[model samples]
Target chain A: MKLFFLLTIFFSFVPILYAQVDTTTLQNNLYDILEDATTDKEGVEYYDLVEYLVQNKIAVNTASIAELMKIPNIDRQSAIAIVRQRNLLGGIKNENDLRSAEGVSEELIDRIISYLIFGDVKDVSFFDSINKNFKAIDFTLRSRGIYDLQQDKAFSDGKYYGSSWKIYNRFVVSKDKNIRVGVLIEKDPGEKSFNDFTTFHFYARDIGFIKNFVAGDFLFEFGHGLTLWSRYSISKGIETVGILPRNGKGIIPYLSSDENMSLRGAAVQFSFNNFNFYTFYSVRNLDGSIDKSTNQITSIRLDGLHRDSSEVAHQRIVNEKLLGISADYSFGEIGSVGLLYYNSTFENDFQHNSLLDPSGNSFDYFAGSYSFTFGKLYFSGETAYNKISLATINSAEIAVDKNFSLLFSYRNYPYDYWSLHSNGFGEKDGTQNESGFYSGFKWRTSYGNIYFYYDQFKYPIGDEKLPLAIKGNEFLIYYSVKPFRDTEFRLRYTNQLKESVAAINGEYGVLSRRKDNLRTELLYKLSKFIQMRSRIELVKTYATAISSEEKGLLLFQDVKYAPTASLSFSGRIVFFQTDSYDSRVYEFENDLTGVMSNPALYGDGMRWYLVARYNTSFGLSLSMKYSELIKPNEKTMGSGDTLINRNVDNRLSFQLDFKF
Target chain B: MNLTIYQLYFWLGADLKFVKDLVFSAAVKKEIGFNPSIRLGTEYSMVDFFKLRIGTSNEPNTYSGGIGIIYQFVQVDYAFFSHPDLGLTHQFGLIIRFTKN
Candidate 1:
């Protein structure tokens, strides 16, 4: 295997050429401020709660307010104004006293003041709290490997079956305030089972009243998710109003290595004093496409690519079952309420060849939620229903203070609301037959912040291109600035129109298209080890009898270096041009570390990537990335089994993060 | 014509109590196309357990080092930088001071 991948990169650089490692410059700039607040397939549960507060820190003078809302942009009115300014200034002493609390800002204490810390809160004994819960047990082993060098046509017609590299592995054992266990394995690159997917889980927390407990896999969200949610959700970004409510941290613990969003069996939660309860049960084995003399099941393969032989005969071929329950109440400050129920089933039977599919074997859901905070306004909401087609959703949020906030949502679904874990707040993709009305806002000023939104949707059974019943509307605006103190700048604009079904004059009607976008960005911190970023984007599209107009442009530049402090480096150089792909453009990069890439700049050449990280004072940490995507007049690059031959496309990845 | 001089020092080392001594630096370049860069660094500490550093830099040349450690309130650091034609670079950091008044 290529000399065992060069002897595993020479014994992983022989322990970084002989020991010497330790890094944390505030958890590597808080993972570059949560990777610039996520994008591109968002959701990493805010980088897993800032990597568990950079390996357990918090304690800004004795935290609490649920430990400052577990960090990410602290909301709950900035964790009740940072515990009411640490009890009226008798504490807090840094990050300018959390920028003098009160709705805290200054980019939220500069992205959580490096995982916080600020003194006094010790005292523990009983074998030092069981040796700090056995040193908060944590064991991680991550591996990533990738290599792709041209040659396409499904590996020259051999229809690939393996080899071309791409492997991933994960193993975790947690215990930082509870307990967790994980395992994941993957193989792709023509998959031929070098372990083509495997996952495992076990979790526990606050055992007394059983506040949480899981077994062999999990994930389930309630309220606000429209019915049931699995797999981190967060749509719309840039903290537009601190993520418009939806603090549903119900039954979690499914360390992503996504091979079909969680749920395998067992789940629990319970509490007494202010009432809380939850329940779950699951059974899975999906990856469908049945239909052999009507055993039904046609379709239901969420990308877990099994590579050849009809995707390995549609792997597992259907079998799913789920059940849930929930209840909650807490009238502490005149708020908190919830109720939920869920059900799902399937073994086969679900074959609807068109007419907008959606034939079933069972499904049900119901929901209600609320959250409040009166004086100074703060409210939250959720309302779901979907007893096979009664589909509905209603969301609300208001924040009226600390610089304005508002959000309003409405959904209808219908068109036979079928559920497979509906993720709501829709515009389609599993929230059934669409129906919408959204409104968003955030103001805050004194040099930065202003977000806006407007949405209006429809699609009541519209298929094969507007067979009638379609509508759309959208608008977005953003503006941000700092202009100083480590610099920052932003500007955004968007407008959408939707409604499609082309081919007039030859039949097939429904028009309206119209997209528009404009963006600008800048971030600077040319010191403390240099950092810089720049971006410019533009996209335009119009269609309705195709009257010309289609444009796209992208620009990028980034550089990051950490001359010392255990060396760091980052690089980017992109330039895009689009006159098609309906004016494509997307940007978000800086990978390796739970990798994610945005790349979607159409046509005209130029792309780049270079990343490096190293830390090995024996507790391994290695990263390497190299990317390329040129296009000097395309020559086949992605189609079918991910085609690629010439027209340049390159990738090389290697990652390892081990800590003991 | 270009000239540069820089110096900084701080000491307390009675077996490293704390330190940050760049001490002295000099650079000279008679521009024709400019290529004059130089640097040097140093650090040492005690109170919080450990820290050690070293540095070197020159226009298209480089060399660097780092180390830091502390336990019971965790802290970790690592560094490495070397380039003569773009190569070596590494970094890692972690800190956790969960209270100490």
Candidate 2:
């Protein structure tokens, strides 16, 4: 019920046009919060939330369960208890109000206090915010250039039309919720034209009964992502019980530079009392390769690259039309339920049946989801049907006390069930054809904290007859301790037995692949201006009853320095060696402001990078990065068109930011 | 009178260098009318910035450990000793010195 006018006022606080406040403290704090949430799969997309929060911090006194759940570590039970506590006490007065909540832990409150506004709150309309600040028309423009020092095979053959330079430009202008516009244009290194990819959006919210309206391009998500989901959904990582639910945010304009995955048409939302309705329609031409004789698609290209003649032939070969609607009803603090239905039709049929991709020309899906909270227990689930097949997931989270919590979830997706725009929880992508049982627990002990999870899965061999009936299991145990006021030590170990189809004795059989990983990390804050991180990881993978095995070792140290208010630097040096590509280790690097890089390293090589940022008082920011990969005995690297003929490879990137 | 009730304990240690990063030390302690305690310890310099040490004594059965973080002209040290009857004791110290020629 708090979604009516608060959302309109939320978007009114548009992105600040300044250079991230031109302070050393803000730069250091942003890195510390995001480092815990980032891995290989989550990088640039997570920056959207941090960027918005830096400018507009939500008032903790008036935040609802939906708003509280948007934070990184808050789970369903904690959010429900917090909202209930806030309503009981009229308004939160201080940290003591947060401590009195049933499920809020001491450690949890301390971590999230930095991103909250403790000042008193007063409800204000969207027009009142406009009247309060007349100079709120914020505009920002950014441009970046990236260049490679070594020449690749694509440049030697002259098959590429563009220079060996990648260019990106974007700008956004907004004033309140009534007027907001954003445009992004980019060109890859070997693209033919200057602006090979472009996307734009126009959005307006909270006018009369219209909660939201968007044209050009937009995105919407509902339920636990068993149906439709946004690009930045929750995935399994170090956090166990805290990341179980997707916390789907409904119908927002897409403001990213990614070329594909966003709908290009119109979407609208309307609210009346406790009921909300959302509807959207999109029709776009996508890139694919089609069989001329059969008029069917061979494969779809999602990379959005047209560097050569072959890639150009696969550009915009098929048209797809989609329509969807969702209706949600809320019962104050008790519970909520939603129902969704969407249909899509493509111009051409799919030639292959991978079971992971959607087949045929026309398809329809209907789903229902609900969430109920009572006392310290919370429950949520979603179930979807696509004509002949069904997919479902049910989960429950319980907070036993202030220091302990438990979670259990069971999911079953038939092998024939498929979704074109869905992302759910499973070992595979969106639980294509898998059934699993997962249980996790988090405990806060006197000395430290403990987090552990266990999962077992199976892929059924039914009438369709998959290659192999596989059974697998995995477990993770993590321990973290604070030995001193400024030092933290963490240790984590994970083991997984993945059963897959392989050739054994010249026949199709199951190969039980076991992977074991152990990681030890330390974080120390020496002083106000210096921070350090040290880590060591070991990985071993082997097949049961097989002689072949692979091992990998990685060691890295990071140092961040903020000597002055206007200047800061971050650097890292990594040493890694793996037996083959299958045993390679991934490391997230310190990159430019809006850029994140996670590269998989194998063989014997050393990689290092340094990023520097300088902000001026006149609202201009300059950023530069230099990185190199050095291998002693390797004369050639990479494969196919991206291969290089040198032992050392380096790259250079620089960006400029201007605001008014 | 004080010497009869409490024993005056003293220990001496000898350092053995294995490499630039790995080192070992052995020590012996003596008290009046009691068995001498023999202790062996090792210290490893994991990097230029960190040092770790651990030691165990035979008599009275006590274990002691310490860690050092060296950054520029300042160094921070933390030591903890676990006694058989005295529970756990923690000590912290900071040292700052400038190198001069």
Candidate 3:
């Protein structure tokens, strides 16, 4: 039954899958930065900000500090220095002028220059621009389909309601810089309805006193995300020092195809003088498994798949309500301070099946944060308190010299602290019982740029494996150098040691494992149209109880060809060998322009992918991607519903973009 | 024969520039799979600086899209894909290129 349902949904969308485009490596560099910050569990949310900056090219000469801060890698101190330098030199005449700013490092300037334009801001007003151009109203449509070759249980048993294809579509309408309205629909394999999931939103920004407003669906981030952050938060990454401080944009419209993790209703922001205020309310239906006898929610379904009868039965079993308010005060060039409060209530109480589960139907959170900069030193911190516990995070960044910088951060989150929407700075998702201290430094020498950090953390109540309180420490060192124009080299090494519970002599005992990772990459622009990248990575794991050590190795070659502005293609071939999943290696891949794919290669395999994009004209673009993994020793691939019949697993995807 | 899965997608789009720097665009897309879905979207770019985008689709019946900025060699795209029965997904992408002549 479930297989039939899945097939029905898959076949329904098959007619439109022809002539789809291939993926492109347009944002490979950005993904490189984000991939460093991502973990196996948490997602990344910086894509929107990068897109905004790309389309609205920041006018470096006239941009405000806030605008400068929107660019990645630009810290508060760097923004201030850029503004001061611009004022002192009358204005930035070119990228070179901005690069010479005090407190600005060569690496920072190189990272931000592409997103900025050194010129006067456009003279046309938002309304005037739209009025003069009837084309100022834009529309876009996109569709994607994915299918697996291997037949799973649902497929073999004919339990899927839809075909094996996963179909997705999106439509949008907008008025330049004024109003936007959008809709999205998707159906996964084995799902019953062609449009099993749908979303709509209308948003407006930068009009009169209303800074921004969203109706339908939206997300917000405030302070360090301890109180109200409805999206992914960076816990740790290669940037090492600069990303410790959270830069929250009060309220923004939500736009994505993810089936979970946002609010429905309305949100609005207003500004008066140096003070800005935002408030939002949302009521949303969530998928979850419920205890029939207790009338309580046993587990929430975040994957948003309803292919089978049991999954469909669990759909929309819980109703959630959220309310939040925030106020921020900016003190000109000195810094800013903000306060946030959020409350969430569920229709059904969350019944705790395990000690780690949170109970009750309502949860409230309060938090405050402040950031200040004085010359070459900057400080920022946030403290959040919930009904049961408190979480605090603080950081200090200092520019020791033009060639060196240092960053330090401390976080303490009590075990009982609970915030459903909190994604604070911690080793795990959400701000719960975890405490850590981190310090990092960056140095730019004539040979290369060096970055390193050390973090020490502990869990008070123990985790899934360790039945007793556990302590862990991690350290990373990274070095990068541009040997020549359009050529670069990078090396990184990381070591992590953590405690876990293990069975010893038929008795449970605490054991610690030390994992070390080393990676080296080289990128070269062979020509104006051809580029190549090569990487080699190694991982080793040593258990305290066992004398033997496990090791893993991965090597890959990447090539990109962009013969013309209208067409480009990239491909990667990877070979990996590992003793076990414990020694797995993670590598980021080039996917669709907006999509990110970084699969962890384990159990010895050969993986490869090809992505290509073609812009037929100024208004039409198409992209497609094909990827496959082969593990000769393994008979079954994947787990659960995604399991494949053979040792080889593969997928194909295509997308199209039309502007005019 | 090797086990193979074939997927297909179709899209139609149009863009108009009424002013020197202002532009408008619209598009429709469809995909075939176990469940077929259709999407519609429109966007407006003001003075080649900022762009606002809106879109809707039927399958799960969700609304999504975002705003973006395109300047010279850099483009920043932000999107919000939401689902009525589920939650929302927000994504941001940045692209930088040094075109060689």
Candidate 4:
């Protein structure tokens, strides 16, 4: 016992005695050295001198972004970057180590070496190495329901109501400060539907190089709703209507968001004079079985009701190739401008079977856009021009989109082909023109936005037999109110009038059509994890072509719930109604009878669905959806009678994406 | 995570500013930037006759690639991203890394 106590006592006193040892002598010496170094440079800036010492291997300290900026030739942004990197690294060990820092340059290191010192002491740990890089595998799956509800619901008439599912996977590899690589794959599964899956165009969309040269299908964007882009698929309902040009299907070397399912092509981009230039080319080929209509106007029956393949073999068509080029220039504070041009040829599988041009047609298209910022306001504009055969039309728009700015626009479209008279006896010869003028005012605040607008449009036809003269004026009022960060209430009321003008024969043109619509929507984002949305629309239309005036209502609601960072659930409901025989005008039906007769006149209907999605850090995601569609009944079709039909569709999809 | 190497001088010396203001008894404002100083660094004494370097400061990072008459630093790297529908997304870039003394 006595020996143990004495040993403890001795150890305790040893620490005290060691601590008591006179460090004053060493401190005095250090003071003397510091005093001398300071006297060597008195008038110079402290930071400048600090860099000098650091360069000379004198002192070491964890430098902040602000501290880095004090060095010559470094900018504020670079300084901030250095600070962020320092945090990421925990702390730099020495001045030379700063080379690995984001903004540190070797030249700056050499220049500052004359004065810097590496004397700071620090601790190191194993965890530091683990944070240097990241690598992971990602996957995604998605399913969608595609349908046109405006067709008749009779079994004799074929209308496609089905769902499509796709699967995707991606693998990513990341190493050391600035290098990464990824690989991905995708496939789609077709579901049973009235329309057979004969032409499912599936191809590798984005397998290529990043940053320098890309050799695969990739998403690209060049202008404000112009040129080409991938995310245009999820456009609004207005965009769904032919009032606007449909987004093209192709790929090119361009800038865009949403990498999945886009155009395919090989492209290269380079930077010069602070501007980036890019170009790309894409190839496409489509072939499928064709179903012929027995009659042009009546008794058109579609076959292959249960067959997976087409009954008739159509002519083989050569591959259709499209080529496009784009260039963009960006200068800080000055804004950006981009231009694009594309050309493609349309071909027919049959040499002389088509009623129209059997050789098909080709069009040359060009688009240009520019965006600039002045103070708190932004100005943007774009123009798209297409030349078809002997006719050319230019569509241009300019928007001064600023806080509380007014917008005005004008459009003119001339149809040179309208001069071709196909009275069934001979070719009709006359030109038709469509023109419009629009002006609007918008008031925007942090909470919401309010807009009011007026638009006038006119269509003039020169053919005496085609008595086509129509004038239209419309007034719109729209507003969205946000009570909270993620919640909004929106309302839109549109009043429109259509008046018949003088016919080619100078007789009073008959009033063709008139329509009005009111729409209301509510969107509530409870948080980043949950959201709910609801919309209601009502329409009333009058037309001399139909016996009765038509009125319809549509209601839709959806809820999205995200329980975790990578998983989401969504459910939707819809109910709609419209005239059964007016599919050519207001396709608001469940079946696609009208669409079968004229695909251009897509029918309308109501649908409900539920979907689930999962996403991973490595750029992978998956989704599954089940949808029920309601259509009109065609089994007992009669004049002015409504059709009722129902369809259930189930789809599964998976996707994987990786960014190198 | 940081790995830095440097040296310091432990000697008494008067800076130019201190000497100039000595008569006025003005407070010495210590400077922090590069000052003229002699430095010793690790070098391959047996292999080189002599090595001289010229550089400018670009702040946080510096422009540092060098053209070496007897020594050279070069690197090549390639990266790729693969997709099921699309084949391979790839990038090829070369970096010529160098240091001078």
Candidate 5:
């Protein structure tokens, strides 16, 4: 019985220990409150008394003895007495009400009222006026300065210093209503004087009906993002996770948090009987400096999705004022199918076409994919086809692709989501786009993963006269394992072959190259706030007779340290052996109409850079980078110097981001 | 003093933004200086996230401003400034902070 009583005592003490207060901070706040009430004098520190009162509304009535003691002037004995009195006499309602309560006085109320407030008190109407409803706003800012160095080599070789800043804001106007806005600014120090700005606007549940709208710059995701899409900061540009491009400033509907696909302009959506329908009309008008090109055409997109009894539905859409319609459907035990059609007039001619005549073209496409689980095995396959052409050409180009994937495993839950996709998959942000069968399967233990995969991409030229055609295939086998809680290691080998078509002697010729790439990486978490990562990439490429040897090894290391909730520091180093630039200039006849030839040389070189960056919650970031481009055993171009040199370059930048 | 602090920050940063406004005054004045104004501005973000904001400080105060966005401790804020004639006379700026969600 004594042991049981002692155990209970220990447990009760744990709660007491956790509830301790910092007396110093309490005393400071008390002094601050007293000082503010007594003096409106300048130089006397002015804490946000109003905001502080609003923030601590609930603690006044429900605070524990420890919590009460934390309030500036309240001692432990007074705190306990106040609690006891409050329990006996309900709770104090107002300043005057507190004056009559036991252990409370008018003078004490006067002193504390300056610093604290109770949110539920309704006797006075002033607090109600000040805080009609709760609302929040959030933002990011960036600024960059640029200094131009050398520009002889396509400006790509120029030494430039730059910086950027951005601020994003989200306003929760109410429980169901929200407004989001953001601004971005950029400065290019390398360019002498250039600045950029971007802004965003958003409204969720805008009409109180079953509708939502977001305007400004946002992303849009159509079917798997193959055609229309958007993705944002969270993930790198990889197709496996099904994200599209991250666009900006447009109005869109809110489907869910995962519905990051946003469009600019006016969007309206309605849901009826398990079927959802949406339509949006958008205008593309923004500052031109951000991107060199602009879209002048007005666009309209419509979508309809439905499912029987179940909430899942098939989807369809028609987009762009000129483009017609597209449709998509899916069902359990069946398959998912998509069809798209578009017809539009071209505003610009490629070369010989007459601008007055205008080319009207139509494209038809179809995509189908299916997946199912069989005991411990899963199988899936997808196929797509597209036919596009100009009516004037009288001939349409067609392209088709198909893929099938299969996996077998035990039912004992042997893997996590990331591991089941093999180590090839990066982070998942719900917006990732899936191309084809990209990953195999694997098992996961505390030690990480064992896996294999094959990836292939082909950009086939439907028109034989087109200037570019690329086909690439990659095969890989890798293992990723974390032997300990804080360490992660990955070892992988990949063999890739690429083929491109180029015009030679007025005829299309194929140039094929193969490379064996070996990669390894290790990430170690030294502590909760510090992490270290190191990686190496080795590439060996063969180009038959011209050059049998073209190989290089790249090494990179990065250390990230976060000492507090608002600040982080990172340092990275990248070193690689630069390839030699072939001084020989090749002239290629125009593939279309076999016109006059143009000559260009592929430069061979190496580059190395190191960058250190610091980020803070106060809307500021700073970075410094030093880079060098080197040419070894040079070859001259014409009568110029042995090699156009790029010496060591240094750049430093700072940015601040916030929202209002 | 606030205006002075703001201008000093911009000058030390060597911000080169151009502005068009310098003063904004309402037809009437009360216990609180409350008014509405329209502003057109341009700004740039540095590589790491610093901002150089240049624009109309007011209808009459065209002061260049240095701005930064800070998001730490789950709170976000923007630091910016306008002209002294409107209020802070030389060093006063605006710091707006809030939580979005």
Candidate 6:
């Protein structure tokens, strides 16, 4: 037994080692963001798109950890290291200088270097900067195709009219910071035409007075998002410290494949001194179901699916027109105030299905926003009015000390408050009928770093399903530590107590529900060329005191190997089991460069996938992935048109990217 | 949901015997999740079918020892492992020969 005692003693003191940057961890998170964007819905507002801000970039030397996170992929650790390194060297000149920082790798620097503007250049004319750096238009093209090996009920039953292949293609032409032209095309499975959904835009920036100009299709994000926000806004999650405040980046070019929710027309922003003025107008068709007998539109479908006859018949049947104008002025140091007013008109009147449903063909909104920074504290807020209702949110962040930070946010959006483009921060999307208070803190201790947040919200006016006003609260605790240079560990636990409308044992009405989640993960490097990760998670959902709790468990192992300079492999094996759908766990897999899939796993099954990437001497790359799921207990894979009448399900995906 | 974890170990082992009554076994293990560890063990025969074994491995590491005995029709082996944090563990093995003529 002497050998066992010796082994135990050696591993005990490992936690005292100094921490270093984990290049693989950074690369993996960056990959996950791009992949999730491929099929991303409104979740987290696609804030993790892993792209730089369109036209607004903060100065690197003066940027805080919160501001630097705007570039995605840059976690709190990396940001802190950068700030520390910059302090030592006074300033950074280029990516190579970043090497002095702990935890940074050459491969990582190569990817994020472009997102950083070394030693911010100030007092230069827009024309001068553009003239000095402008080059020939850089062109990029990407095309992808996906297929399912097993036939689904939708195609087998002839309910879908087209092939089962999903096709997507996009291209962008950009010249420095001067101009960008982009077009995207997508056709989901069972869609009839190749160009069923199309989006294109031409954006110009950094001109004399025209701060930004856009034609065709584009997105607008400003202020707290109550009045207008369309793209890349994060919601409440593990990153509680930085999520409460949204640093508006103004108008951004749209290129993703999201079919709807984009303004199509012309917009321009004129800036003079510290004052900026904006004007925008858009007209677009929406997929809506109409009540033929009354000529009234009943519903606006946002799914963007056109497969069946009824779905195809309602495609682009309703027209929506929008007009808006706004102005903002910079005040004191690190502060600004702005106002916005907009009007919307629909071609047809909406059918009054419920009292909360928006009726009539025209609506108007007015809003005001402000952001101020004092010493080490930051504050921001916005309030909007829509004739009958009002919505507002106020938030603050304070750096109590070098080791402690705190954040607080409060929002109240009455049920009647309605804004078509409101992607604000609240318990629910659209920021309606929600009132909540969120308090979070980030603390760095000698043992590790701790992040905690508690959010309490309630629906003053519930929807049809939930007829009564209900209150809920959610709390999250996250802890992370890296004892060794190449080793890291993370643990998170989140618990939510909410009331929902559900039928348990014939009891309907509001039922109390509780959801608790716990996850632990480990990442370390085996050698210079290989990295590995292991994770395990548990989920539990208790409907009520009288009902039993639903439990779920998931475990996965990952391996990343780069044996050669031009080729690499990433693979994972997952095992998951859940009591029911309510407790199912969602897992995001590493797809090709621009592809990602987050699928909910249930039942007793094992899933695995391997992705291989190869880069040639030229500007061409190839990636392929093969994934399969085996459920020993289930007879079918899904339900409705998506059901696969087999125990095993699999798919093949391919993508090609080229640049010149 | 991509991340990192630390403190796990994967191990590889091999045994080499150079002399008539002596045998040596060694393992080289890497802890992708923790730290590197190595365990060295050796066995010496006391009689025709009796042997004694001892080994040690190390930081919050371990120590182990075992013995094996073989008589005409049956053989039994026992081993023990000890660690600072893991306490102690005992393992046993048995073998019986079956033949018909």
DockQ of each: 0.01, 0.02, 0.01, 0.00, 0.01, 0.04
Candidate 2 residue pairs in backbone clash: none
Better of 1 and 4 by lDDT: 1
Candidate 3, residues A388-456, lDDT tens digits: the string is 777899999998887888999999988778776777887777677789999999899999999999999
- Cα lDDT tens digits, model 1, A333-407, are 456788998778887778887666767777677878787788766666676666544665555566666677787
RMSD to the true structure for each prediction, in A, is 26.9, 13.4, 19.0, 31.9, 27.8, 10.1
- Point out the higher-scoring one by lDDT: 3 or 6: 3
Please identify which of the two predictions, 5 or 6, would achieve the higher lDDT against the true structure.
6
Q: Which ten residues in a row have the lowest lDDT in candidate 6 chain A?
A: A1-10
**What fraction of the true interface does each of the listed models get right, in terms of native contacts kept?**
0.00, 0.00, 0.00, 0.00, 0.00, 0.00
On a 0 to 100 scale, what is the lDDT of residue A572 in model 4? 54
Name the better of 1 and 5 by DockQ.
1
Q: Write the per-residue lDDT of candidate 2 for residues B47-95, one digit (tens) a residue.
A: 9999998888887888889999999999999989887787898889899
Backbone atom clashes (below 3 Å) for every candidate: 15, 0, 117, 98, 99, 35
TM-score of every model versus the real structure: 0.28, 0.81, 0.81, 0.45, 0.45, 0.79
How would you class the docking of model 4? incorrect
DockQ of 5: 0.01
| Residue ranges of candidate 1 with Cα displaced over 4 Å | A1-79, A82-98, A102-146, A149-157, A161-226, A233-287, A298-300, A312-333, A336-360, A372-419, A422-527, A530-560, A563-624, A627-660, B1-101
Poorest stretch of ten by lDDT in candidate 1 chain A: A1-10
**lDDT-best of 3 and 5:** 3
lDDT of each: 0.68, 0.73, 0.75, 0.38, 0.34, 0.73
lDDT of 4 by residue, A35-122 (tens): 2121121211222123222422322354433234334233233344455555676655666466676544443354444433344543
